[model samples]
Target: MTYFVTLEGETYEEARESFSWDVPDGFNAAVDLVRKHDDGDRVALHQAFPDGRRERYSFDDLDRRSSAVANALESLGLAFGDRVAVVVPQKPANVLTHLACWKLGAVSLPLSVLFGTDALRYRLTDSEARIAVVDVSQWETIREVAPDCPDLEAVLVVDGEPEIEGGTVGDASVSRFETAIDWRDDDHEVAETDVDTPAIVMYTSGSTGKPKGVLHTHGVWLGHCPAFSMYFERDLEGTYWTPADWAWIGALGDLVFPAWHYGQPVVGFPMGSFDPETAFELLAEFDVTGSFLPPTAIRMLMDVDDPADRYELSLRAICSGGEPLTPEILEWAEAELEGTVVNELYGQTEANLLVTNCREWFPAKAGSMGKPVPGHEVAVLDPETGERVGAGEVGEIAVRRDDDPVVFAEYWNDPEKTAAATLERGDGDGQRTGVRSESDGMPEGQAWHLTGDLAERDAEGYLWFKSRDDDLIITSGYRVGPREVEEAILEHPSVAQVGVVGVADDRRGKIIKAVVQPAAGTAGSEELREEIRELVRDRLADYEYPRAIEFREELPQTTTGKIRRSELE
Candidate 1:
């Protein structure tokens, strides 16, 4: 039952027979998958620092270190299911802490290291985290905010001295992670937890309002790895790199879990800054076989003047997600990179990759999101009527949840929000409704997780993406999706990258405003704006073209490579 398909041009299949998981009552990802399945000598992680320092950890090293961390947490009397907030940059300690939590069956809440005292306090307070693992650099900031987070019991510093400040419970209780694991005779057994129990609380990218914690179970997360391996046909012995934070599910799904399950070594470069050349060098030096990045990073590499000569990319497969893959970028990768296939997948934090286009399926339809992965059913339905849409017609993209085990359990502590996303009826339409009735053996709303993204299913069963439902701009009585306009503008040779958003317009309600980052040495002017508008006019409908274009040096992007559209709007 393993699914196989060509992405870009190469064909691959999953090692697992099926995507289904019979969760064995109580499941622990770290123990069952990492400890039990992994060979002790296999390199689990290789971390390189910006200062030219490097550290490697084998599965045995990870197991022992994580066991010590588990013991330390237990010694502090923090039991299973207690929340532990971690605010550290990408590093070995960060990864180890997560593995430690998984071993203890404690929920790991990874926070962005960029957060100041105010932002950090919010997540700590919201999750009611009892322990905080923070970077030494941010220790002062954490100290400032720790008093406000009454639930915070201890602070584990990663790269500096553990000084116990006064006025905190039990003298600030800090532990330094620079030392090797002092494994004691204490047999730190992995906790037995229900498969449905919360394993990780991943916060949404927060493009709209406050970030919501999307709760996922062990079964759901583990189910994703096999699907990923099947999709990529990843070599079990090859090296993989995903320049994504573990906080994001994309990293967890595509990099961590699969690599661990198959015993492949993974490289994690965790600096706060991104250097395209350095990234390229890393790929070349490591002989990375498979790598995944956001389209933004790919575009950045493409924008480099001498990419082919500068870096020797021995990559077998190059995967991009977090946003739509532009045809221009795809074309560039094919031309410049030797025999590398670009794989694009469509997924969200709520679910791992539901649909993907492989490298063997190269020369794919320019705008299509490809076919649904086997074992899942995908449909395009009218948002209001819930009727399945005809080919090429835009509607909400809904995936059938009947047999899909990778779907999230629920939103953490937000039953009302969960109900809104999962329980709503499909307008009582027989054809469009994924749920038959409450008694039909399907949960009322859980029958389908309404992916707020809008798209169209082509005659070939391939899904063509449109835009997010909230991102549709209504201007001058005309509705427009920013993606269409951005795609149109991107056709202009002078435009390096463009972000389209709805700016306030009294006459038009909300006119299309495009922020463009021009090609090198290109000047921004009214003429350039008009030229972009004309290009859009040629490709898109008259109403969908950008009326106003603002030039920018760069555009903001998320860790997953999606444009921060909320930042622009």
Candidate 2:
């Protein structure tokens, strides 16, 4: 009765029938990612620089450095469950900090380097980490935020030399990465942790206006394996990379852990910001064979026509999430990227990698999120009753929480919010699946975590993303999902990025409006605007087409690179 796929599957049904979860009593993130995999000189990562330099780090290098940093942090009074804020780009130091924190049984909170001073201060103050590992560029600013983060006691600066006698800055101790760990022995043992022991806390992109910390356990690694395998396929080769920021679960769970679990080297190429040309360069230069490209990245990559003719690329598999993978882009990837297949993934920080499409196992539907991956039950149900809706009807996606290892431990410290994610629904033929929260939970509810997304399941079992509950537009009597309209407009060559939202209207309750960022050298004009409007009208319903179109050089995006639809107004 099991439908679990072992990391490699010849057929979807065959794989699921043989799949299972095996989280052991004694589990450690460090041991799983670095300890057992390291054969001393096996390269673990390749850190690429903007200056065209690349440095390789072996498993032995990480093992030695992480153990030393673990001991150093422990000496500074960091204990089990203590949070360590790791603020850096995709670099060796960032990986080392995470491994070290896990080795000491501490929670690693990864914040993006793209975050400004205010965003950095907010996360530091909120997570209340006892220590922080930051880049040298942020050493001076860390002191400015230290007063606001009273719980933070130590700051380890990467790529900088310690300046002070005792390495003290304000109320917190500050020392360089090497200086802090140089005095400690590099042979410390990893902490013995349970499958349920908390490991990492990642903040959501806050597309809803406020960010919340999502805490996950050690079992998450086991939970991510099957889908990762499904998306990347068997016998992973060459280097794995993702343009997604390393702080997000898209990179950490989908690429880093899964790639490292197979002992494949990951490219930590932080280009400061995502550039389509630079991304192509890194993939070619490093011979990257597999990657998880975000939807935006793939869309931008489409701008380069005849890419197969332009550069030499080793990419064979590319899995994308964080946005819908429009058919236009998928077609472009398949046609121009040589052998790359773009499999779409669907999940949030709360529940990573729940659904995926596997190469050769099945044919991908245009813009479909694919079926639920092996090891998960997925259903589209009514938001209020949790009853299964008939095929072709939209419903909130929900995941069964009882014994679900991939579900996060809790919303960091917010019990009400954590409890809010789960609900008691009538268990009338309930299936495991993957939405937004309902205000009132029925008293006699079965445990199900809502994903806050709206989607429809076809008779064939493929699910298509409609829009976030908050982003759904109601104009007159017709209902519209912004994504449906956005995808239509994106098919037009001139459009690069767009955010669709419903604005208040006098005649209709709200009218659809699209704020678009055109392609480079393309101007937003009346003729172009009409073409975008006509494109949507021809593709989707007239109600879904934007009544108004505004042009801009850029759109507001969350730190994680998701468009902020709430800000479109």
Candidate 3:
């Protein structure tokens, strides 16, 4: 049976064999994937704004705009390996800038528009980015901090007139992006880039301190399209929508690049905000076949009074990532959205979509992350010994890098941190017996990337997510998973959202604190907090119950919808 799940078709695997991963040597994604595969006539990007404005870009148009941006960068004397920081909201100009960087073989650093001036400076300095392409609205923030960044040479403003300010030292140049694109030539050649060459440097959300720049190569990203296409069972002919920002790997690889590679039309809602009603309208309007939304968005959509009445979902499959999809959200989507199966994919910026539950493989266990993708090996290992854990046992989620083609190379400019993250145990006697190791270990070539996530594997080889290693809340020698506590709190109808964190306590060493966003119009009170604590105690272990509850309007979340537990803590 073909493994394809269609509105009308065979199983997905049978249909998937037609499309395979066969990246050519010195392949630049802009030239090889987007331009060559999509060609000139196919619509590549359809961007809709909340203000009723819409723009469409064909593959040829994307190619031309990107080339223009590349030529403009070259005119500024930026070359291969030079870092270019892009600080724009989810918009067409952001997409153009990213592709343009790929054309010039420059490393693109995509920064979150929500970040303040200090956060921007940290990334710029850390990557040593030479130029920054920023939206005009954010120009003041960048301008305020640009003086402190000695390495920054140019600031190109998108959608704003350039006004040079006084005391701007060095050869710092300012130009309107529209004027800069005039230097673009239709036939500008794409520079040759090695497969292992760094294409993007994505910064992790720095909850602890400064964010680390995770470097991904052309080879890594090139493999992403094939893997995602296979997992989602996306046809090269269908439309795909991933409601995320360009700053995130989920949006960049899973939505934009992969869809482009498959010669599929991609849709972007670039109003720089997410509303369930608007999202539902777009899905109906575009007749999107495949789509992705965070679990939170799914919940919001579920809360809509009459989703079926409001939207016509031609969507064959929908997936959620960035955070685990709750069972409540899953059931809601199935019932309200024409019985569409909501598959969950588990991955991070460090590694994109490592394990994904296929739409055809529905009824997946709640909180399970599914099996590892083909060509990738996933294991649950004892955090200290690095020994593979037995079935139904929770351990650190580790990926064998030797066979995983999608694994990232290193953290840019931070070799020590990279070594720590990518290095694992080797097959050696005594201390290393039956242990998984890094490339520096196993006979000079094998390595494994340590996924900081903690998970468990059942007897059937289904992987179940537990919590991030750092996210595990320990109180009085009890190992409590925040997700379990959060899940229990979510059982309450009044609890719209919650984040559990361990707070330092004098008596218990640490205590569980649940920061909750109550359902709209629900009043917060001491009685409610006590009620929630008792409810958790009934559902979970005694230690897992949150001792205190703090009410908030909404829980802090990353752009991709993962709750910012660190921020809550």
Candidate 4:
């Protein structure tokens, strides 16, 4: 429960030398985040609903409720390694659902609450989720979507009205959250899983134009410890809050679970959407001290005139990522936030929090991505030969995968894609969890996981991000796969060819733009454009729909018929 990393000297190098990653052979995320911290009176979460309702949940409440959920899932025939879809937002039910899954040794597959029917169907089908725990808003849609998901046997609806009776919805059984767990015993036996066991399967946009699942092991939490403490400079004893959705690794791994692991309270507001004014109110109201705010969110906050004077705040540390923090944003935050420091953190869904800034220990270079986080090795590697590039030379950012607990187990079941991004192994340093074994699904080879992000390392070891090497789009901190959007647009019969690109924006870091070539002899019209926009919004996510759509006579493509996104950009 103590701070994961220790800081003895006033230097990043000294901090790195002083820290070590220690995880026991027998591990379970439920034990670490909830059960072990179950002191009946200590507050674990402070939740606020938009309806003016507020409540505090103790660790005791969480342990009992999560155990009851575990028992309920077992009664429904859930077994070890079964995937359960958690499609709720910041509600206590969302966290409880994850804890319940880990306790039963089931994998938690989280999907954004903003996803539409098409987005929901893909993840549920690909993960083969046996049950989906969703908010009431999705109940009507899930009723229509469940028949297409073969493994879906039940839907547990949260926050549903009494009239929304629990019964058979299509072929899947429907049950109310309270009705299912209220009578179950809170002493269900927790599965004794290991550090390497599969825990979370988070879907992310990939270069191949599909949303691939990034499977992280139970050790993933331990892998994030060093960076979490470092990012905040060990200033995490107080309450934590983040506007980031709990489904994101930046929120779940960086803030929520880590805060609980340290026996600290986390404030939860299902804000429904982000409003800078509302965010300030919640931050001041709860006395939150730590958070993981994305740079794009920070930009939105900057537009609020004088936040420090307008609201009483207690933020000691704020970690930012997704896009580089511009100098103007950093300067504004430094002067306005008083004591809080906005540190840039680097990592993707596959290997997160690997690079960070601890301004309390060492001065960070302006416009630099800080330094490699302690306990994790980061380097600029030549993409072709997999050799370390010299200083000041641009190369792909990569992290050693050999026994690195932060490296994902695999891209769900796509071993071919996994092998493509991984570099051949080098000798083991034995720092991360343990040595890689074929039993671990990967052998000793493929030691480096190529991030596909271009960057350069300075002589002082600070990394400067260059650009993304693929067609993926990061808009307002959400990673959107251009391919996913294009595929959705292609589903429309009027669209013959499509190209999706991310254009720079002042407010959102990037905005999605789709260029379309109408089907043979089909002329594009305003009605067709509106219809296409509606199709994307219905099939993908509301946040992922193209902001601008253009009708083109032809789209530039490679010889293989792949849309040339570079030309579109």
Candidate 5:
């Protein structure tokens, strides 16, 4: 077997002790991982379209097609370090774009196809991308925004041309993807890049502030080998799928990169509006063995009646991320979806998945984020003093950087923000510690990466998520996280989804406010509000319960499906 990381022992403790990422510099995704592990004849991607169309691409097909794309891009005058912004959906072209970028040492920036013209323009301008690869259906957005993005030099349509006038971006050229790669050779020399060379730049959704570009390097891709092995039980013989856009890091990092690195085929679909029935059909039809869905998607599926009896699911492992998973959803999944526990994964766009409740290694508890995966040192620290907090104490969740080979290189061109996010050891000044011998395997550093999220560690070492540091609620003298209150309210039989925020109050400083979307056929009333408040009070502390509840049919969300809590205020 090709050398890939795997569990070496029976328990989580032993697995952690054995885990290591012996990553080296000059790692190229196209040459190092894919070309090395992929057997030419095996399927690499299986794309199932909604209109009853399906296509499969073997590893050899991707290798040749991506090389053609690289040659085509180079012919267009694109060079190393050039940013190629891609606004395509979950099609095969999307995967090809990333692989082609790696071959040229160019940085690929994936923008959500759901982003509006304004959002699209902001990212294009911020990243200063020279070229854009977009779908024909979304050409209007590009045309409207391209005029404002002076840095964008050309546009490459994925399938065909759109019915629009030309000269959109100051005479910027437009061509179809198929036409560009038509005559190109099926092979190109992969660029030799150092571990620190920027490979990709992903932007935050700007739920709080202006979107910031998170830059990652080629070596970080190598780190995913151990991160996946420690937290995920890979089934080389099984199919993989994630119900998220390839633009999101969750799908790209969790599903695409690691799966291909270990030589496994992945399922892809153009995500329009998500329908539970269609999702069920795909899972059954494909006989998917491993998959992941967001918490919101799971909540919607739970409303479907008798899913277990309706569909024959072949799922062996189920996982979730993007938000905390509620106990109610987990119970439903275990009962209806092949008796598999939904593992809750935790991480940010800056740092891929750092923690998980990996069922293969450890048993899970309700509402906990589980332990830090091997190769990461995660702890709760005092935000003020930067000291490690004791059990049951609430503080910022941080990861020590010394041992992490995958921590992001930097926030794109923002040194001050990067410095602010880095944490010092204890109360001491941030400085370099002496390098440890290879036997210890620790890097030379005295700083930790502050995650900017609040959490607490239990006596058993499980980490309970609280809220984003800015999202912490301060009512009177007590601090509360909205997730804790939201989790309790979601357990109500009448609630479908909930978002908790801190509303201004003169006496208490800030009062707990719950904005809820009631379950179908359930009417929202004062009586139901009181019942939810009572439920929270019983499940959590008295002060933690919401003082006010406002009902809504649906909450505003970003393109990636995270709730827009700031907009609610």
Candidate 6:
């Protein structure tokens, strides 16, 4: 029950050395962690609705309700290893469904509520989700895509009765969340599963190509403890909240799971979309102590003048990820939210947060992506030679396979892609190597997992993110990352936001193009564009400046707030 272990040591080095983790062979997260350590009568989930309504669920309540859900699934004939798609907003039902899946040893796939019919169909078919536990509003999209997903057995609608056309969902059955758990027994036993057992399958946006299902095992849950503990400074009785949807790892892995794993209560607000005013009201109303805010959301909040004067915020530390946290945004947040440190964190769905600006341990670095998290070996490597790059040299970000447990098992059912993701030690140099496996313990040499993202390490050992590997721009035999250009252009007072991309050119092979969204009161003019270009030219090399600038009211962005550079390209 006392899973909340406080990390000791005054310096980051001492903390990293003192950190330790030991997870049992067969670990059932819901049963072993939540149920075993029940902080009786304490609020485990505090949810706020957009209509000014609120609800609370205790730790014991979630445990029992989740068991009821597990029993209900069993009654409906769903068994272990089955895929259950969860497509709902941040609600008590979302946590209930995930815990139920864990109890039944089923694989849970969380799909974003903002996803379109096509995106929904792609995931449902790709992950082969058998049962979809979705919101009533999203039922129509599921109905349309049900015919394409042959494995879809039924759709469990939450928040309302299932209004199926002719009372049927094609061959797939339809049921309500309340009805499913109404008569079901609230005492389902946690299924026996090993640490390596498949627990969840999350899909990437696949902006580059078809979405790939990233699978993580039950054991990876252990890795989040020390990683999040070091970053968020897990407080047992403190209130926590995340504005991100339950679908993304930023919300699920970084906040929800970690909070539950470390015996901390979390606030869930299903506002549907981001709203600065509502966010301020909820945080102050709930007295939230800590949170993780993405860069995109931070940008929107920056517009709110003097946030501290508007509401009293209880935030001690704030973490950001997903996109780069510009210095402007950081400075604004720290100033607006008094006494709060807006620290930036770095990681992907493939592996959870690998690097972070641990504000509790070290001061915040404005634009740097901090140092590699303890237990995970992260480095910027030369892609061709698989050699570690020197300071200030841009290279592919790779995680060294050394006693690290957070690395994913495989890209669900794609062995070709799995092998491609791994780099053999000195294989490119034609060196003979023996067969070494992850199961046989840590093997020596330069073997690593390719992250496919480009970054450079500064002299301080802090990694500075650049751009995606495929997104790299090469013009006239010179290399350029859109981030550097975008950062420079963003420095202009008239420029509000910008997305840079490489466009096809007959002469230079590829030319740098800047898509900018000007600030209010500032018009997109040739004169203003020239001024922006002049700012960039003075800051960066002449060739690195954007050759062309296109102004828009807003840049194309995904639901998660990442800019869609592919659309611009």
Model 1 per-residue lDDT tens digits across residues 1-569: 11222122133233112434445555676765457643677888888888898888888878787888888877776788898887777687777777788878898887877776777778788888888888877778887887788788887778866454323533246666554236663347888876676777777877755777887766565556544654465444688887776667777776667667666788988756667888888998887888778776787787667666778777877766656577877778778887576777777878777777654433466666666765565667677656567888898877665546567777878877775565334334443334333232333554677778888887876787778888888998987888888777777878877888999988889888898889889989999988888888889878878888888898876544567788876
lDDT of 4 by residue, 54-145 (tens): 99999888888899899898889999999999988889989999999998999998877776788789989999999999899888778778
Comparison by TM-score, 1 against 4, better one: 1
Misplaced by over 4 Å in model 3 are 1-22, 162-171, 234-236, 424-445
User: What tens-digit string does per-residue lDDT give for candidate 5 at 1-569?
Assistant: 13454556677788778877665556677765567764678888889987899999988788888888888889888999999998998898898888999999999999988888889988999899999999877788887898888888888887764443233455468877777675449898889886678899988767667788999887666565555654456444677788888897878887677788778888998868888888888888888777778888888787788887898888777778767687777788788775866878788877767778777767788888888877777878776655568899998887776646567767888987787788543433423221222212223345577788888899978888889988888999998888889889988989888889999999999999999999999989999999998999999999999998999999888776787788665
Kindly give the number of clashing pairs for every candidate: 17, 17, 16, 0, 0, 0
Per-residue alpha-carbon lDDT of candidate 6 for residues 497-559, written as tens digits (9 for 90 to 100): 889999999999999999999987888999998998888889888898889889999888766
Q: Choose 2 or 3, whichever is better by TM-score.
A: 2
Candidate 5: RMSD over Cα atoms?
Answer: 3.4
Number of the predicted model whose lDDT against the real structure is largest: 2
The residue ranges of model 4 lying beyond 4 angstroms of the native Cα positions read: 1-10, 38-40, 206-208, 426-446, 471-569
For model 5 the TM-score comes to 0.94
Q: What are the Cα lDDT values of the candidates?
A: 0.71, 0.81, 0.75, 0.79, 0.79, 0.78
RMSD of 6: 3.0
Superposed by TM-score, candidate 3 places the C-alpha of residue 34 at a distance from the truth, in angstroms, of 1.2
TM-score of each: 0.89, 0.93, 0.91, 0.80, 0.94, 0.94
| Root-mean-square deviation of Cα positions for candidate 2 versus the true structure, in angstroms | 3.9
- Candidate 6 Cα outliers beyond 4 Å, as residue runs: 1-6, 162-166, 233-237, 401-403, 426-447
TM-score of 4: 0.80
After TM-score superposition, what is the CA distance of residue 191 in candidate 5 from its true location, in Å?
A: 0.4
Q: Give the TM-score of candidate 6.
A: 0.94
Model 1 spans with C-alpha error above 4 angstroms? 1-19, 162-172, 179-181, 184-187, 234-236, 305-310, 361-363, 424-446, 558-561
Cα misplacement distance, residue 513 of candidate 1 (Å): 1.3
Candidate 1, poorest ten consecutive residues by summed lDDT: 1-10
How big is the positional error of residue 277 in model 6, measured in Å on the Cα after superposition?
Answer: 0.5
Candidates 2 and 3 compared by lDDT, better number: 2
Off by over 4 Å in 2: 1-5, 38-40, 161-169, 425-446
lDDT of 2 by residue, 136-178 (tens): 7777777677788888898888887646425766578877777
